[model samples]
Target: MARRGGDDRTLDLLAWQPPEPQRYAEERVRTATLRDRISRAVSETLKDCEQTRADVARAMGEWLGEDVSENMLNAYASQGREEHTIPYLRLLALVQVTGDTRLLQLGAELFDTTVIENRLKPFIEIGMRFDRRNRAVAIAQEEDREIDVAIRTIRKGARQ
Candidate 1:
């Protein structure tokens, strides 16, 4: 077989072998349609609670200090994932105001219950278990326990 000019590879090696074009096109269309439907639903839901949304936006801007957009607000509302807890709490407050039960349930479901109970709670408990005065062996033991639990959870999750 003749090698291609660029890297001396055969055409069979260099040529793209994408999925069947018609199937790919159909998948793309389906994804686009689903996205459109979800967007419309969110838009309609937001419109029904425009005043609450505006309040949430204003509160988030005030809390985040003028660097937020409606899109950011929307993401915060739709998905509670955030680098900081401030946006999550603010979004929750807004949802409370709006009486949006669905968003509330979604947020509750998305909240990382396992991490909160297993990781954060244990860390805090260990911190509190050690006295400020005698902070040598007890602190070390607590820290070790926290680390062990964390490692075990990580291993378990990996296995699963």
Candidate 2:
């Protein structure tokens, strides 16, 4: 294929094939509200933690340089206390203290996104590049089809 007048040589997009889809752990379809999810995450993380609620709160307070009382933590984790939502920074501190990244993953899932370790980001980037390449090839083929149709019409007009 001839190179375009750009820095990179044009690829033969027509010959390109898309990569196979990858499957990860499938999450069950949930009907819970965000508020419920947040409350559940806080409760679950606390239950799994070795530290007491007071200790977790103290660590969170220290991490944020603010007063995070055990009562406040309880309120944040209480499903009935819809108004007592955990602040973003407080949630971050809680995750840091408990090392429960699912708290962040819950939020990411709301936007159809996933939370992954830093080490795996390059592999995700590779998949993204493949998606981009597939889109480019599709667009190029469409443009080529339009050009061919136009050329055919002009040739028929000249023959008449």
* Top candidate by TM-score: 2
> What does candidate 2 score on TM?
0.70
How many clashing residue pairs appear in each of the predictions shown?
0, 0
What's the C-alpha lDDT at position 50 in model 1? 55
Instruction: Give a tens-digit lDDT track for model 1, residues 104-140.
Output: 3333433642212233555466557765536777788
What is the lDDT for 2 in model 2? 55
TM-score of candidate 1 on Cα atoms, chains taken together: 0.27
Error of 2 at 98 (Å): 1.0
Least accurate stretch of 10 residues (summed lDDT) in model 2?
20-29
- Top candidate when judged by lDDT against the true structure: 2
Model 1: how far residue 89 lies from native, Å: 1.8
